[model samples]
Target: MDRFGDGLVFVVALVLIGWWIWRRFDNWLHEPPSSRLRKLAQAGEVEPDEAVDFLQEHGYSVLSGKHRVPLGVIVDDGPVQTTRLYFDYFAAKEDRYYLVRLERSRQPIDWTASGLRERLLPYALLFPECDGIIVADPKDRLLRTVRFRVEDEKA
Candidate 1:
């Protein structure tokens, strides 16, 4: 009876291990793809425009175009003010993703470091996953990528 009980225990343990393995495999098979992959897969849906052409010329593939992020700001418990932040395009180069901003005559971007921080930093901060911001000045035929790093001040 003792040997029979031991064999039964071993069979139960093997069954449990098999069940666990099957569950893990099933979950992995059904798991959703990463957001980056999803975005890249959807890149084909975007309509190609001048910005896309400009980005492609710079060796970056345009992923998505024209994003408008809505914002609701309340200052000092006052009424909420609604506004929108606009992004010209999303592009990728060598597996790195970047948020593209087109230079406009109406809303020109300041090229200085502080100016860049003021204008482009928000977009970078908002999309922390993006590698950086790509400033595309198609009229000037220029493409620049901007990245930010935080440094601690030593007293």
Candidate 2:
């Protein structure tokens, strides 16, 4: 092969390898919990409804059945850009709101108290109106919560 042809081949191979690595990392990080739920369903271990059952069993009245809430944030362009935040479950019980963040099994479910606190901080900052945040993985049978206390905007 000519030198130019070999160089072109090397560039193409590098691009393909980079693309594969990117896809693998993306899948690892963003594996959907629904796929796990499907596995649970097939195994007859736990049905998808049980996620809500788990929440209800713990005293959270399901306020939203998978809903996206629109939020406005100021970007470099100056005008507020609308962004959507998706939560698996939005529940309220005893006058306090709870936002549930679900994780896939590949993602780390076990976290130190401070680690879990850090994970929920973004939800707290973005959705300050919510009273608390919870992270649950049914496959791992784990649940963690942090009461997110946002200062009143008036202050």
Question: Which segments of model 1 are wrong by more than 4 Å?
Answer: 1-45
- The lDDT, on a scale of 0 to 1, for candidate 2 is 0.69
lDDT of each: 0.83, 0.69
User: Which residue pairs overlap in candidate 2's backbone?
Assistant: none
Per-residue lDDT of candidate 1, residues 21-90 (tens digit): 9999998788654464445436544687777888898899887777777899999999999999988788
Tens digit of lDDT per residue, candidate 2, span 4-45?
999999999999999999999999789864443333223322
Report residue 149 deviation for candidate 1 (angstroms): 0.8
Give the TM-score of each candidate.
0.71, 0.50
